[model samples]
Target chain A: MTERWKRTLVAAALGLALLLPGGGIARADSWQDRVSAGSAAATARGTTIEIAMLDRVTGQYRDNGPAAHTRIESASVMKVFIAEHVLHQRDLGKKAVTQTDLADMSRMLRASENAPANRLWVAYGANGIIADIKARYGLTETGPTSNTRYWGNTMITAHDMVVFYQRLMDGSGGLSARSRDWIVEQLRQSVEWGDGGRQFFGLRDGLPREQVISQKQGWMCCVNGHIYRHTSGYAGPDNRFIVVVLTREPSGRGGAHIEASITAAVRAMFPEGLVPRVQGQIGEMWVRSGGHRGPLGLPNTDEIPVRGGAVQYFQGGGAYWSPATGPHWVIGSILQRYRAMGYETGRLGYPTSDEIALPGGALSRFQGGYVYWSPATGAHAVMQPILAAYAAQKWETGRLRYPTSGEIALPGGGVMNRFQGGHVYWSSRTGAHWVIGSILGVYKAQGYQAGPLGYPLTDEVALAGGAVSHFEGGSVYWSPGRGAHALRGALLEAYQAQGAERGSLGYPVSDAYAAADGTRMDFQGGSLTVPSASSTTTTTAPPAAPAPGAPTGAGTATAPVAPSDGAATGGDAQP
Target chain B: MRPLRPAVAAALVLLAATGCTDAPPAARSDGPAPATSSSSGPAPAPPAGEEEAQALAPLPDGVATGTAVLVYSGLGELREPFAGQCSHDGSTTRIEGTADTARIVLEVTPDGARIDLDDGGVRSSSELSAGRYEVSGGHLSLRADMTQDGESTGTAELEIDCGG
Candidate 1:
């Protein structure tokens, strides 16, 4: 067989494997298949239904067709927007909600009462409420009717409705926690009959009784010879999923017929009468982990299958499961670091252990490495040689401290990881070594591994006053009075000729700077100047015109200049 | 498809007994009513007798009060009567009433009359066939064919007097 055909066959096999239990990845086509079936059922009923659902956990959004984006009159669904706005205002202290107002709001939501809605609509400025709701929720295809008298005519799309519900439930819709809870509570308390008519249809009736749902229903008739029926809400375990279904049928059909069609569509979409699953071992673990209140929080997504295992996300963390490893929860910063490293797909692979707290931070061991996090350094993964070097320093409690950055690859085939105190750079040639303190600063100023200094040949060594470190291209020296500076090429030879740090030149106080003629370096005892060509060196005393080939204000060198080719000219004058 | 002649003859006999002129209701109260009549037919003519005497007879004045009964038998069955009032301003007679959740209004003239009815969530309006009318002893009654929502239902009758 051709290579392409062979690859396709293997891929098909793997896809089938993922469908089996203990397959870590989620079924990608489940929602799509259900949506297609539901759409067909709705069409067969002679009604057009638009559906949009969002799995808050996985952040997966699904729509059956273009109807999801199509605008339809909101009918009584607009009342929810009005209620949210009013409650939001009350939360902001802009509106004082009295007992009467609350009662009316409850009646408005519970029974779909028109009188209360009418009162609130006029009081709140009908169009203004819709505009605020649209803007706050980022509803692209929603707007108030031109005639404010008809609040029910506000236009909305199924997709936008789902987004609104998600945000409202997820605490991102700008409603205070109390307000959101109140609104959700009201929706949950919805009765079978509303002030306008019977409304206990759609998602509420279609889904199983075991599935808890907080919903809003809307219906209106005889507009453009069509009747509108809409049902939307949060559903499933912990209300982790948002479902919105909007439909319009010919006005000649009775409300009961239209309502039944909507219910049929919903039933088709969830034949098993459930939203995304959160049951089995994962459900038990979620409960043990404190469910919605735990560090893992509520499941944001259904259990998703990955290679060899399945993973599920929660509000605060994630849960990973494998047949070999069972199920474990990774929380907080460690979880974030794992995700950044591509979760199980990356080198870190699946986590092998839950977070283990150390003296200064916490860590989670993964198949490939360990992610460590501390209040001071956030989180970073340490692997292989670097990890060994970190262990040598005693981890977070050691001198190296917690890692502040993950392994960063250098231009050449080397890797470097940053820590609170210093860095551990690793390569095949250099293995792994720590660079710390002032000596490490001078090394970094030269561009770390990519700079002319290349890799560090040795760790910092103690001197009489300070320390020094040697690099591939040169060495950096430090002293109590001179800080640190790099010396290389002819400059290094000249410094050695003058007895190096113990000589009259002492330790380099500043790196090389560009002279009018060549390069110059300042030291504690004196300055070294190298002319670019064979030129006469004249030393002019204090505040005098600079030498013909000398740079003006040359002693305050901030950075190293490229080494000149000419021979060095030593000077005894202090800078 | 009831014959129109019989209804017209009954109206003429009532007019002759009341000793009232065959002038349009609007002409007596304010100004002449429009020449248009209900789809049913035109009003009946008076017998040629005592025209001068009929002209000398005093015309009914001011507002008339009464009760209106409506029987609907289309989609469902409903029978209701509303205490009502009517006023004449030479050009036309406007009658209105409300009972329970239903309301009705009839605008009448010598040529024709139209009715607007709102009841049991159904709102409809249609013209009424030219009806027989009697005015005597401070009492007036009108019986006319009725239709609702564009479908013929039955008939509506009103009996009242010019008490106030």
Candidate 2:
């Protein structure tokens, strides 16, 4: 299996390198080629790929695609859902699933026991299971076949499976950030072992120590003359970016082969810098918050006060995502690329940049989230759409990536290619219509030398739209005012606000005065009062609160916020 | 009502707006009191910042207050019920378990505070742990701890309000 990975990487290295002639920009073909190669070489025959990439940064989905809607089979990946759903219900003031339910899920997922799966299925029943899925999971294409009927032709598709994994990973809904955190801790804390299945190295290989991958494997010896095997889980942070591969009619070592292949294929998308790079080896990690992340890798702090979260960095050491350690961790892991991209750290109130990645393609980028590209081979780039907020730009376009930054030089070219109202105006030496930002698009096609007609889209809305752009060799573009937009989602919000462009909004903008194609967005402060039946657009700036007396150093903030009798309520508790 | 001319009317209107009960008092009720505690910071804010100090005050009929879910995020939600019950009984009051999700125990005294919670019921023995919580209406807040004892064990918060 390891040899297969080496072969693909070696093959890809030679062919893919020249594909992306420019050092930074990636060609989309590279990503697809890597996926195709891993699928073909790693798994012998029937195995297929089912991937669902979420942009946690934007809380939007880049590509649900065909597999997203299909109902194939939950297999072990369903365990994550069961674990999260069971726990969320408990937090929502609903009765906690009985220890019996937990034990059943644990045995089924943590232990890969069919018996416990069956027991829980019977106990929860179809309606019971479906209710939790709908309520806690917000799943669109999933329902129970009944506890008794579970595994009785039980089926789920790769796409729906991805959603389930994502939902399990994201517990922010109806739950505190800490709540979802505990779930992540649980997923990571538990791992399956014994029976030579331990060192399988399928999910373990490829990434760094931060990813405490928790997955389930299934082997089916059909009644007829056939055999099938499947495996799925979050190959990276939060298990939201799920990868599932299934192969039928395989050889004796089918489980191991398929398992290893799926990891490789997905890992190709993760690249090097994407996954949380846990500092130190396992057991030596500095795990914080979710100290009790049993088996699911969800956050759950025991005894110690949960650090309302931490300043996460995509570094090697620390707690959460520090798979080297046990379940003790919380806040988010660091996405080292965030700082490299030039985003100000300690802002956004997030603990780590680990889950943050540069959007992969049009769909992924517009999905509005952060993504990470390996500073190394750049073979893969993992994306996590922001939940509601997004980064319009990487903290910096060029400042050299971390650790190895000292060795390489970053051009620091502004990541954004200026376009007028969705029309390309600057940057890109090639195509008449340039593709920039985290997406690719046909710009106005009008080469401008400057002034009005030359600047047809100068502040004017470009009839063309904008999207997060993806290239042939896996390179992603981040453009806000271009021929790309999120249609309507968090990615659009992020791209417009944090796009790598100099003038992009540093913070998320609530309202935008979008022009014809929406590529042009500006804060009018108030509604744009377009004349009746007229084509011209006019807007008035919203009235601003009179600025407080410019602070003369001794700005005296009254104690309307009284001190907390020494406890220090952080003074937010105004009676 | 007709204004007795522009000048008088302006004065009256200003008085009315500022005088209405919905707004906070326009001026300091009394001069700052001498420091009541060692860490002097304006005499402990006249003890009016948190509503608990007014526990003995009576309310008009039909105007009872309790915490409610005033705002909600689409997939997000948070709720905090005020300390109507706790205020009347000093800094401690046992809830009948409206079964709120914050999973906290509210306590107040003169000095520090203590909050206790075992995320997801995954408890262990440890020393002091840092936590986030809110306290308003003279009631201590459990800073949105998001976990549950998936088993039967419940998590608790120990808050030490001032007025110890």
Candidate 3:
């Protein structure tokens, strides 16, 4: 009947629709399968390929066979180890690296210059360099060539390279942060034209720009009748992942052919680039909603499982999925509110609908409640008996307006909500009712519900001459002729004994106040005074006959009944 | 000078016919070539540098003498003549030679021989067919066509004495 109810029903229907069989969008392939298949296809091309991938966040490592541990010629990749050893020495102040040394290091890293590598290799003995790096990085299968004169002959395995990179990134490789970052920065600036030849093969050319690659490449021919092409690097945000591809093709393959083979292998592993793919039902919904460029933005993490289904956080928001709810995204302030309420484990449960736009703001519905947001009021949850009361009053369109805060517990086992228009109070004894206008002002003057007025028992009722709202202690009456006032305790009893509003003393025009004698209430016809509480007296015009057609007892004011099921019935009402 | 043996004269004729007349003698060899003598007491010892070069070679067997000529145009122009010994254990023969800083290692198998050439800093590898071999005067010579990236780049000529 109300706008809130209509929106809730619509959300419920959409949630139900998401639960149908095959409701999820279809995807061509999962990322894991695609990467596995791609790796296999590349290996089948007559190259002995070894791959190692490390997820920095999860500390999970993946590889495509024992070749990751099989040592091959390091080629120019040995330059990285050489650089690390030199930098570590520099870090310890054991060696003063001059500006010339820095320039040479940069040349060696960015351009893969052999002269600089050879110079550094001799300066820091080849055996010492290998020994230092091996001990520092715990490389199990990396060693110097028997003839240390040929730095390119240093043997290294993909697994050891990954471990070296991981240690370098985590600042445990005996290099200071400055040294580590410098090395990584030089790698990031690697040029396509290195001293040996084209360097932008494999990860650099194969992966998308989204991967943010920083790499070192190695290529050398006819070491034991095999040509080695290796690409190793940091990929993804903040270098959150490491990828190493080591390949050795039979001798005599052209440089371009070998490089392309490595690149194809890398491309196969990451068809969608290096940003982890969002897959399955969540991925389908993401595409439907515009994919990486959509409102959800790019997925910052892989789909992670929760209690019921899974959730994947994107740059824009988090997409949550469940068998019952399909997929839905909660964004902005509403998402913050839901998180504060404990996410899916909280009272609100999983989102049943995507954020729904309203005239002034937006709302997202959940199993237990709704998180509503407005430019002026931020976001807050609305649930249960209070929601029903708000729905009966037509939600935000009614007098209560938008809720300013979530349900807050009172000291006396009651709950209260502050709204733009007024306040909603709920207690087991008093049900749920809103206090607003001048009567609320008078109740505030009497210390609100916490004072003698207690909780509101009924909403304001319109009388022939004024309005009235009953509270636990007494009642507040409002009239244009005498303003609003509260009548309570002994004074209220004395006024009722003289027939209350139907008696000679009409609706109270002034709240009960402390006088020189005791507490007093001023009415239109007369006043009721309780001096010292022991006795109370009412002065009025001669007991006038009840006004013709005047109602008796508590008038027509009725308290809002709490919902039987206690389920939220409105889109934006607070509990 | 002592007269050339008939086998050596015939091998020289074969070498000239095969466009190897320009092949230079071992200029950087450890010693002068041994003179031919009529007496059959014992043979002379080989050059001094040959023993060290043979030890350094990545060969499976003992040393053998060889003359190597490599002509390649890929990466950069390389036309070099190296007089050195080759080595073979049994199945594979490795002929490694260096002219100044440029070096080339040719590994010959029954199927094919692979040439790993490094002319200064520019390097390239190419596979060549198992060449035609001729043995005369206790010397064996191999002539093969070298192909790189599936394209014929040049030819490699090697003559070695493996004591067969």
Best by DockQ: 3
Q: Compute DockQ for each candidate against the true complex.
A: 0.01, 0.01, 0.03
Q: Model 1 over residues A71-114: C-alpha lDDT tens digits?
A: 88887887889899999999889999989999998987877776
The window of 10 residues in a row where model 3 chain A has the poorest summed lDDT is A560-569
Tens digits of per-residue lDDT, candidate 2, A502-566, equal 22222112223344633233321222333334544443353443123211122234211101121
DockQ of candidate 2, scored on C-alphas against the true complex (2 decimals): 0.01
Docking class of 1: incorrect
Q: Can you write out model 2's per-residue Cα lDDT over B38-81, one digit (the tens) per residue?
A: 11221111111123222212211122234432110000112344
Compared with the true structure, all predictions reach lDDT values of 0.68, 0.33, 0.69
> Between 1 and 2, whose DockQ is larger?
1
Of candidate 2 chain A, the 10-residue stretch with the lowest lDDT total is A559-568
What ranges in model 2 sit over 4 Å off? Answer: A1-45, A58-69, A88-104, A134-136, A143-147, A172-182, A194-201, A208-210, A214-219, A223-228, A235-253, A267-575, B1-164
Tens-place lDDT per residue, model 1, B11-111, is 66987977665676754585322211111123323321222122212225445566665532211112344556556656566667665566778676555
Order of models, best TM-score first: 3, 1, 2
Residue B46 lDDT in model 2? 16
Candidate 3: tens digits of C-alpha lDDT, residues A1-575: 99999877865553332222221113233433444545676677877787776666555456655566778778788788888889889999999999999999999899887667767888898778988898887787787776555677677887778888988987777899999999999999988766525677788777755557889988765444566678998986589778888888876665556666787888777655554556667877877787655688778888889999889998889999989989999889999998899998898888899888887888888888777788988898887677777777787777767788888788778887766666778899999888776776666667777888899998777665567789998887766545667777788788878877767676675677777777776766666678885675747453344333333435446422211111211222332
